[model samples]
Target: MKAFLASLVVALVVAVGAAWLLETTYQSTAADAYATNGARVGDPGHNLVGTDWYSSRS
Candidate 1:
């Protein structure tokens, strides 16, 4: 019926709006963090070029 259709549309709109808001908030926060911390967020890889068990298979 009309009520169901209207509710579906309202729900879709709310979902889309919520997704947009979350994305925007995340982007803003990430930008602020990057501006302050300059992309050195975590430690570098430890054994990337070493002869470990997996690397020695070749």
Candidate 2:
């Protein structure tokens, strides 16, 4: 039982670390790709994920 608990803790730590690493990698890649194409990163005006329905522009 003790060994199983230790293994479980190790597995959890590895999974969390992998998730964090992947997120960081993805963000960096996205930023690099945008920069290569002359697009700005993190600009809400050019958000690709959602629409800005609240904007007052015509």
Candidates in order have lDDT scores of 0.69, 0.74
RMSD of 1: 8.3
Give the per-residue lDDT digits (tens) of candidate 1, residues 31-58: 3566545575443345346555464467
Per candidate, the number of residue pairs that clash is 0, 0
Mark the regions of model 1 whose C-alpha exceeds 4 Å error after superposition.
26-58
The number of residue pairs in model 1 that clash at the backbone is: 0
> What tens-digit string does per-residue lDDT give for candidate 2 at 1-58?
9999999999999999999988977555556567655675675446564654565687
Clashing pairs in 1: none
Prediction 1 TM-score vs. true: 0.46
Candidate 2 regions off by >4 Å?
A: 26-58
